[model samples]
Target: MSENASATELTSQYTAQVTADLERNTKEQERVGVEIAALQEQLASLQRDHTVLVNIQQAIDAVPVPDSTAPPSGNVPVPAPRKKAAPSGRAERTRPSKKTRPSRKTAAQPAQTAGQTAGKSTGKSAGKSAGKPSAGKAEAVQTAQATLVDLVRRHLTEQSEPRSAAEIATALGQAHPERAIKTTVIRTTLEGLVAKTQAQRSKQGSSVFYTAADPSRSAATARSEEQPEPADA
Candidate 1:
């Protein structure tokens, strides 16, 4: 009888211990999940900030630098030439000749990019325009896009991990709100730019983050082996 009682007690103790261990493991798992969620949120926020910064940097790069000699504001006087030109019978080349002209009508002002829906100079104008990107201004837009794409590529390369488009845009917007970046525009630009950059698209569950890849001579070289080689090559 005593032996039977001892066995029962031992079994009970083992069952209690197993239960305790299971509960402890569950709690630890919950904690880990919570931590992961927090980290993901933090990472997303950083990505948005990065995107905003990239857009702003692109805008800064795109905005043509005005001829300093022909200051937009005439308040600042340009220095007068010290020596008068010695006249040859041929028309003398004037130092103050208006050689440089802005390429576009709004060359004096800022230009817009594709998918940028906001005010002409404000974020509002770009939002309303469903108009396609112009063929004439394609070169200018491409130039701006390239600058922004390069900035984003560099930003990703500098980061230790992948980043979400929203996070990238938020970072860029915060860095340069004056540029008036729209989240949609940022998202679209990043997607298009990624094609050129050959950045890695990492999927954590359903969420996608872009991881910067090493830039080779061309993006084709950076492509995954799964992708087919270009026909031209």
Candidate 2:
């Protein structure tokens, strides 16, 4: 009887796992579908812009450049040049005196540039030395940085199931609108992470998904989610 009970429990567990995976897969499909639709819309807009640009270029090409021989539309006549009297031999001999200037300014320019560079370096060093961040500020600085891979890895860790690159890009973009997150960048980062074994990649039919490096984390998350919440007192 115990053997039969164990078998039934095992079957039930498998069923639950299968169910969870199925549901996750469905959600992923829907999310990717939405991202694909958005991408298509963007592509259409870009194509329209491209068409407009091509038309403008063709129009520009069709217009011939005006030539010098052509008369002006205003019908303005060219003015004759006025003749000037030539200087006397004495005046011509007494040309403006050319004084040789000392290379003071030219020589000083390099010195001034060097001084400015030194001053800038000194100021930077002084600021870095004097205006040190407090422990909190230092931590915050480390927390908010330009490392996209770190950001993507952290994002993946928080997710229960694998996520598509488009979905990840969209989520990150919405969360950090100023950053202007892009799906191509996300996909490239994900590929690098996978190569490093810092992230896991899985495919469902034509769709690819990424998740945390740890394979078992997703299973654990699913189990936890499946667990019922405690009833109200």
Candidate 3:
């Protein structure tokens, strides 16, 4: 009977020890799980920081380096760093004050003073009397009298075959360096002459060419037409 009691007591003590050990193991497992979670969060933060640092390094490398062989011009100027703006809620109002408008009487006084000054001044008449014929005015009068059509006609007549408008404008420019001639003006003038039957125009591909009309042939044709037909003979 005593042996049976001793065996039961030993079994109960063993069971209690096992239960205590299980409880300690459960608490240790919970602590380890929390540490693992904290480590994962730190790793994620470190990875994000590493990525940001790598991007900054790449941007710095992308900047161009100045040539070392070139001469240096004193100290390089550094731009001032911009200041950070204050929070919107904390910012102070900086609106400008309204400006006053000028009175109409003050505005009219300037005009009256200007008119009185003009009435007292007789310098304009003296300036007109002292003025002589300017060289620029004389040159302008000469250019006005010079006919561009006559010049283009002469150039076409001098050429053996048809000439392009660009060639004519270039020849005219070379002949009269003072005049600023354009190909479009020459082309318009050629078209005008073609309309008036004073010049012949031919198109070869995309180029338009001009030739002076034959005066002799035209005169002969006119004379033949003028002579009355000899009685149907």
Among these predictions, the greatest lDDT belongs to: 2
Q: What ordering of candidates by TM-score runs from best to worst?
A: 2, 3, 1
Query: What is the lDDT, from 0 to 100, of the residue 168 in candidate 3?
Result: 95
Give RMSD to native, each candidate.
Answer: 22.9, 20.3, 48.1
Tens-digit lDDT string for candidate 3 (1-103) = 9999999999999999999999999977855654454345446545655665565556545555434344334333334455577678756643323455455
Angstrom error of the Cα, residue 31, model 1: value is: 1.4
Question: Over all chains combined, what TM-score does candidate 1 have?
Answer: 0.31
Residue 207 error, candidate 2, Å? 0.6
Give Cα-based local distance difference scores for all models.
0.57, 0.69, 0.68
- Winner on TM-score between 1 and 2 is 2
Worst lDDT window (10 residues) for model 2?
A: 70-79
After superposing candidate 3, which stretches have Cα over 4 Å from the reference? 1-145, 217-233
Per-prediction backbone clash count: 26, 0, 0
Question: lDDT by residue for model 2 over 116-196, one digit each (tens)?
Answer: 666666567755544443433445435443456667888998999889999999998888786667898688777766655
2 or 3, which is superior by lDDT? 2
